[model samples]
Target: MKKNLWIGGEYQSASSYMELKNPFNLEILAHIGIANQGDVLSAIKAAEDAKDIMTEMPAFERAEILEKVAQYLKDDREECARLIALEAAKPLKAAKSEVDRTIMTYTFAAHEARRIHGETVPMDAAPGGQGRLAFTIREPIGVIAAITPFNFPMNLVAHKVGPAIAAGNSVVLKPASQTPLSAYKIADYFHAAGLPAGALNVITGSGSKIGDILMKDDRIKMITFTGSPEVGRYIRENSGLKRVTLELGSNSALIVDEGVQIANVIPRIVNGAFAYQGQVCISIQRIYVHEKVFEAFVEKFVSETHKLKAGNPLEEDIDISAMITRGDVQRTKDWVEEAIKNGAELKAGGHSEEGIFQPTVLVNVASSEKVSCEEVFAPVVHINSFRHFDDAINLVNDSKYGLQAGIFTNDIHKALQAAKKLHVGGVMINEIPTFRVDQMPYGGVKMSGMGREGIKYAVEEMTELKLISFKTE
Candidate 1:
């Protein structure tokens, strides 16, 4: 397939193009037109031109457009899923799930479009303010620049673009070059749904070249990004006065307490650690099990993990597949090897074939080891024992990236206590850290990120509050 850049609701080609290859096998899936810095500037100009059109549109009209886009996606669900799997090498089942979530995200945005409410102020409470009437209103911040990551090309893009549109803001999107087909399809949906020209523009090319343009443009009022902490920091520092919402990386942890049933949660743990090749930001990387149930937990966890099938992502039963690139596999392998050299014992499956690394489990890993400390964006997990609940909380909070943590305990008091003391964005009681629905306020503390990402929360980030007051004589 040949994909063109979508700018101002029109598809166009450039002189240079890039080929997107399947990560599992070096097969060219599609050729996407590349946008230079000049093209990026054009996109920014288009979004700036659409500011009045977006702001003047009625909320019901905006909601209708978003609903139509959601219907378009549902009409072509299988095709979208196949494109995601072909470009990102995600398993077919997981790709389908992602498509479902993307549909829900747009639907939620549609609902939020009509629900932007403001509250009236009580001026009578203040002295000399008897006849004054005051209230606050939310308004769009104009042009938004959305930079999305490759791991979740469809849904993460939806998280940014959907909310921006719901908040009545025009957008210029920069999808990851490695996976631009999904973004292209979404742009087609927006156009087909009768969104006005220039309301949404999708640009594809080198992130550094186009990203710099997006950041430096004064017309852009906000920038929303999802990537590494290093890039997030750069955006924060350089985005001068523009509102920024960053969804950065994480090394998520999970705790298994003494009273938990080992058999009941083994499957959840296995899926949490290995799903989508463990490329997700909140994929389980560090696990702390209470000493009383440590042996039983490891035995069942490794047994279930080994049962997962590794094969072509197109297959229905394959649970493990290739990483985004061979470089990622190599980095993950190097970390695991370093941990082993430092006296960590490999429990099962620690090798690589082609671009796929086996779902690996390690024990006795030191807290300072690379595999334990760093964000290993591959299918590898480290399990350590903790004697008490306090010890488990300390172990989970020891890392710099406190995105989300999970604790399993039947006692309500223990679970509530852990929720209060975990030092992360979310503490899942009796659930895995990978648990996330599209409607919740999702973000992290410390190095994880700077803002939340649910549809309503994201709309808040994309807008600004204005106070309107009047004196009634």
Candidate 2:
């Protein structure tokens, strides 16, 4: 495959390159353009210029461009989904779903762009700070440096780019080293749909090198990142005086209440845990089940999990594929072993290495076990049983990562109670923690990260409100 850097509405190539592989079956897919400092600066400059024009562009025109981009994606659905699966190691169904979500998020952002109205502050009604007629109007921050993660490559890019574009900010996108092409595809669509030359740029390379340079660049006004907590912290510490939005790691939780039927819920939960080989940040890493239904749920859950066909992502009926690399398999194996040794019993599918890992489940897992406490991106599920609703809520709250949770109870009172007390970004009733709608506000609490990603809320978080007025003297 011919891969090149997309800078300023065009493709540029360098002699240096990075090799991209299909994690499933370990085949080389293509060589990607590896960007250096010079390329990064040029992309930043282009985006800065785009931001300057974007602010003055009619809001209706901006919204039309966003809508056109969404249409372009929908028109090219099959191509995009296939690329997502091959490059990002996502299963076909989930890969297609990512494309679906990207279309939805972009469309929502398009509609929102036109509605970026400022509310009139009745200065007369407010106390002294008035006469200013301080109506808050949303203004696009200058330029954004968006660094996305491997999992949900297309959707995560949409999460950042959609909001930035909606708020009229120019953006320079850096896809994960492992997953790059899909993002370039997004930039191509925006350009094809008649976006201004400097509106969006895509550059891909080593995170340790290009990531820091992008963050430290003075021209880049905002840095929006989605990755590990360690890297998130590094970006915040180094990106001096710039606005930052970090969607970091999550060892998300799912609570199975005593009321929701166990058999009815396990399939969706298993799909969430094993989908995309469990690479998603919002996947169910820890599951807390009420004591009344704990063992029953486990019985059905394990049986259903065995039926999950695990193999090449390109092949049909394969639920889980090989992880991103053989090293990923090795590390996951080691973590599983550590958890097993630390008194967590392996319930199902613990084999790993050779770039393939079986969907694993561990029960009677200690609260302190690494599998339970840490973010295991593998298809392993840690099950802990609680006798009461309050106890289960407490157990879920104990963890530091709180991206999302699922409460499977029919009782509205209990569900509402759990939702209020869950302390996470989202609460899903009658669903697994993997449930996410493109329009919903998606983010986490505590160490997981800052800010939200779903379209409307993200636009609010991505831009600044500057109230301007003309004196009617």
Instruction: List, residue by residue over 141-171, the lDDT tens digit for candidate 1.
Output: 9999999999989999999999999999999
Best by TM-score: 1
lDDT winner among the candidates?
1
- For model 2, the superposed segments whose C-alpha errors exceed 4 Å read 126-132, 469-473
Cα lDDT tens digits, model 2, 71-109, are: 988999988989988987788877888899899988998
Per-residue lDDT value at 439 in model 2: 87
Per-candidate Cα lDDT values, in order, are 0.91, 0.85
Clash number by candidate, in order: 0, 0
Instruction: Kindly report which residue stretches of model 1 are placed more than 4 angstroms away from their true locations once superposed.
Output: none
Candidate 1 local distance difference test against the native: 0.91
Give the worst 10-residue stretch by lDDT in candidate 1. 7-16
Cα deviation of 167, candidate 2, in Å: 1.5
Model 1 vs. true fold: TM:
0.99
